[model samples]
Target: MLAQYLLGKFRALVRLLIQCVSPRQVKLETATYLRGSKTSELDDEDHNVVEWAFSGAYDGDKPILIDAENPARSLSKNKSLDLVTRLSGSFEPGSTVCLHLQNNILYPILVLAILATGCKWTGTNPACTRSELEDHLRVSRSKYIITSEDHEDMVFDVLCRMDEDIELILFSDVTVERPPSKDGKHPTLHDLLANSTFLPLESRYQRLSARTAATLMASSGTTGLPKMAIRAHGALVCESRSDELQDAHKPYKIRRLFCTPMFHAYSFPKMVINPLRQGQPTYYMQRFDDTFIQKLSLYSITDIITVPPILSRLVDQARGGDAKPLLQSLRTIICAGAPLTVKLRDEFIQLFSNPPQLIQEWGMTECGCISRAGDLDADMPTTVGRPVAGYLVKISQEERVEIPGGGFASELLVKGPQLMDCYLGDDSATASHVTSDGWYKTGDVGYLDARGRIFLVDRAKDIIKVNGWQVSAAELEKTVLQVPGVMDAAALSMGHSLDEHPYICVVRTDHGVSEKEIREVLRSQLSRYKGSRCELQFVDGLPRAASGKLLRRKLKAQLTHREK
Candidate 1:
């Protein structure tokens, strides 16, 4: 440990000396460096000056989010800036806005404007059901919702059902007929932007403290409702700046293609900020589908910011000799949001010539990015690398249990500036996850190597990863229990790795209800991914403790024993 510490310090010293002597010029494009970054007037107010600089960092005129529907369709950074200006003037300062639109080019502008106005912003996955969306809206307490004609029906349904006092701001062309406001005019997002004569200078340049809550995002919960996490203004700024600095040091420009939901924290930086700062174009996917391989070759995508399932599909495509030419253009591929199996990673590397830099990042909604493993030894395919810059990692063994690799497996604890303030409106949940001093309990059971690389073994919480999306076991269990004959149900992951499928074990009450009927009921309630590929088992009884709490581990053991 002492030797490793000394070696780390020595490397740091060498880097500092090299930086001092060489003094490399900041070579980032206009989007990263503001033209008027050094203002003489606000020199006295350091926080205000910092805010000005942070806002200005995204002032470039380049296209940020490109429309996937039409390759020619794109939105420039300036258009977003104008919209932000208009939005600031339209809404009260420091107000919270919930953006729940489909993957569109306008998302970047909305995010920037929200941050610039010193207001809080929250967004939900468009795939979320009205009930799920309602839960998020009720928790966040967002009065203004920015959606489009595409999701108008669903959004309106949520609004009507909840009876929450919220305003709808349409971004695209208004196709739905609705009653006008008391002012007797149907106002759209475009109308607001078109009518604005000048920027709302006051709100646009509002001086916000670093600790102010900038984003209130939701967790991909393993149980119950999704927990809201408040990300501070300083945390966002720091992460963006870090990306900028990293890009400055890179030799080649990054033309990233983003298809993940814009609301997700994993996708936000890559989709909106990182590509913008690098002066590189970001192509937004309407959805990840069969057309993805076509887009890669069509747009000459240099980097793909996607999940494991997409990568697995790409690998399968390569095996069929379809993705040879286009795959070469990809220099880097970032996989996150769910675990990437060693089999998938190895196949990806073997299939491509000059294989893309495969970077596996581990993070949750509450914490932006925890660890990223860029370079890994062939033997250590499970390694998630060390903690990212400005984060610390330590394993807190809840119980002394032997691990497979001759070590004790334990829960991973993280401490970082980018860690969330708290789970919004859920004091108990927040308190449980966050320690008294600082450490955030990442409910991931993993072991650290001698070199500090993290290898995940199991989940402390019961969550199923389906195609890189988190499907809560409890949530699925709830859906299964709703079936007519199901007295009790428990959901678990069927596949070992990337082929993860949600499987359910059920205790039936009625004799007439068949497995097919139960499946049909579940299919009606849950999404396609969660409903399909689900294997059901009729169990005589569910393993439970005396207090009626589930003995999941014991049930899993019984199932494994039966399979053998």
Candidate 2:
């Protein structure tokens, strides 16, 4: 009894010592950097993501993944695991599996099956044009393409043109009762799942280590063509584990409504691993449409992870006063992908009767979610909160010099377990983005506050320099969006690098607001150096990627072509 008491006291003392030694911000040499309050040791674990995800204790018969389009189409834990085990025998080890399908109930299951078989998985947008699809296939060097019947012709054509002997597989919605492939040339996912055999519990399946590449997520090609980012099993496992730890303290259960594309990195891990691990019911929307507001109320969705454009649309709908009651069931709205402006954040929160916490997270395809705003930091509108567990953040100027807190915005650098292994097949590109010392240059210009909160100014490449002043395009775009008649806006630099000018493209409402009025508003709200010489062009709509990031390079190319 005495020994037991002593051991308990020793554990308590160790916990107290750790708390005392933990610092909110660490000083490294002359620069101050921020480290996550929590640290995870799963970075070096030699385990496959599939094994880690399924190891969680959860109800096997619970309907955790449901289709919002057809409520009857749902997957319980047992059903999903069964499908995964059966389909795991289809792929050979170390081959790449590419998915070209829209958001559906079966997508996540396919992702799991691919990873379980010791193969790399990549997904392309279903709506990609023929050439774009070909480019993706060429870059990913995918050995097998899994697509729906709707896209089979396009996929076949692209494969034929490339003269690659890639196998093609067809997928159907979970609700469909697909027949076996008549020709046997291309098998359906259902056909694979119906196979009686399972993967041998022996040496046939290769063991996956932490460093093994599990996913090849395509980066959002905002600047140019998309590159496939290789993510290791350990990285994904670390990311999911971090999120699970963070949510462990929450008081209420999370019932998520996921409308974001499953193919993108922003939503991939969350959709594939989180719901099952947490034993939470997640509704999958094929696409965000007119029925979104009603579905939220019908399902009593407590949480949603979406992009800013969808939130803006929701805020606009809330103006009618009907959406207020429908949205009251929501307890949290986590926005990522593109920047969420202070104006939109505040406006949207105020519209809710019982306002849901609108949290903004900062991250990219190359890295998983870097930071997320907490409930306490919600009032600090512009901040993306502090770094999560296993992340270190710093700022770099011209010579890797760190500026003091609240000083001018510098390029943000992050080191974390969730960082992608490499830009797949592009070693030079990987070296250019990541420094030798292990810091990943985010290419985003932001500053760390004294409190260690991060505030994103703009993408380093998107900062427009006019005269001697550096202006943030995101800030300017935010200001433009506040105008009453403006529905959407994007800011671009229109001149040479040394001498650049701001050009604002806007999509106006039917209210028919004039250009002079927008300029007047900008002139009143912004300084002369920031807004005076701005040029405005009215357009029907702005082009954006599936992740809601503005396609600025594509837009600039279109504008330049028109001028020519």
Candidate 3:
């Protein structure tokens, strides 16, 4: 493993060096250009060509010119300059092209535009929703979206909803929507691609700097509406951004993990993409199932990124002596989305006995992964670790907010390349939250210790005003989950009455545990007022998206539907 990692790095360093000094305009290493591949046997020409490709071949291994005559032609010297003349021209820095994958066919122009000049391209699936598709659309500000015959409906939906104007064509050709008596929607992605002719990329678009914003992604913000976050082209300057690397501080090969869906900003950036940039394989669960998660080792997985809920299931499975060796094969396991409690942390450490290190990360949609710590695996006090590179963070207390260190527990504000440019076209809402300077108001309640570890308390939106006091729904939910039979809990203020009391409901698990035991557990651990202020209800499970985010609206709807 070490040999493979070192070889990959050595090749990358060589490639970086060649790009700076040599004029490499031709050739690519079809296999070696990727981040971390297991195969080693290759010709000497492939090695040097990979080195040149990394430096200049289509802006770093995008496969523009391909295996041309005499593969080692340097772009600077006359020998390579001739090859460059034969090949495509340079690309703008911020162009992030979207590869609309259809069956196995690769479109020629789509390949040239993306591979020609180091412009980045990311592949997408057809099943993505309009809002889900918009994240990538907004994140990447994608140059062109290539879609097949069937997926144009979703693309049109997003284009209609977007505030920014975007140029559209199809993966197949120019689309012509069959008119309903000349009054119908336009043609589809397939039609557009099939009919479109090659036009020179506008000259103005060719000179963009790499630091310029290329893409954007949206997430469920603390506000009721979705907020867009920017993902700059510069974010991928390094082959392996250290922040997303495995804890060993090594570029580990990312293999398979299916617990998370691709649509989530967290999973898309951290799990799926970070690895793909490094050319590692990622297998998504598509959907999660306990027995399948328990049997993952059969497929030879090396890493996994998950939240507390999934980790809890792993512990539950491990407690019964199942999935032991499978987990033993694991390299790095990351956790976020909620705090990893000391009780649960200790249980994992004791059971795994020096198994995969648990990293508790703290981040939100406003920015990507901010902090992570290994102390979490050892049962250290919970705090989202220090900020990663290319990011700045500050915590300040306003009138309604409070933190332990005077300003320690205030709203966390972040500014970084990964921050979104704006929410589509909602300028008023975007201007209201993002400052003139660039600081985004996170609306998150957290305190940063002197060492920079952040402890999240709750969302400012989820804060419950009770009797002139603020009660954190997170605090209540944490306590409820500790109950022997409780699976999940969510708390929302019913409405502020003159009486000012908390109305909390806990969803208890039916894992053969009784409601009497659950309520008794809460009563024994909580104060009389706190204990008596809540009701216990047995539920199958809390409503969640494929990405494991709670859908509070659905929970509220479920309560209303049941009441009726």
TM-score of each candidate structure, all chains considered together: 0.84, 0.75, 0.52
- Candidate 1 residue 425 C-alpha distance from true site, Å: 0.7
Candidate 1 residue-wise lDDT, 124-224, digit = tens: 87767776788788888887888876788788888888867888877753222244333522357666555555755455655677677878887756565
| Residue-by-residue lDDT tens digits, candidate 3, 78-187 | 22222222222323444666755432212223433443344554545455445546755665567666665476666877787888665454443211234222322443
lDDT of 2 by residue, 297-362 (tens): 999898898777688778788788977788877877888766667667767767754455677778
Question: In candidate 3, where is summed lDDT lowest over 10 consecutive residues?
Answer: 30-39
lDDT comparing candidate 2 with the true structure: 0.76
Model 1, C-alpha of 317: deviation from truth (Å) = 2.0
lDDT of each: 0.70, 0.76, 0.50
Give me the displacement of residue 554 in model 3, in angstroms.
23
Model 1, which residues run further than 4 Å from truth?
A: 1-59, 173-186, 194-197, 200-205, 376-379, 510-512
Q: Candidate 1 vs. truth: CA RMSD?
A: 9.6
Where is the poorest 10-residue window by lDDT in model 2? 22-31
Using lDDT as the measure, what is the rank order of every candidate, best first? Answer: 2, 1, 3
CA RMSD of all predictions: 9.6, 12.0, 17.0
Query: In model 2, where do residues sit more than 4 Å from their true spots?
Result: 1-31, 41-44, 173-179, 194-196, 200-206, 220-223, 399-406, 462-564
lDDT of 3 at 472: 51
lDDT of 2 at 277: 70
Q: Candidate 2: give the clashing pairs.
A: none
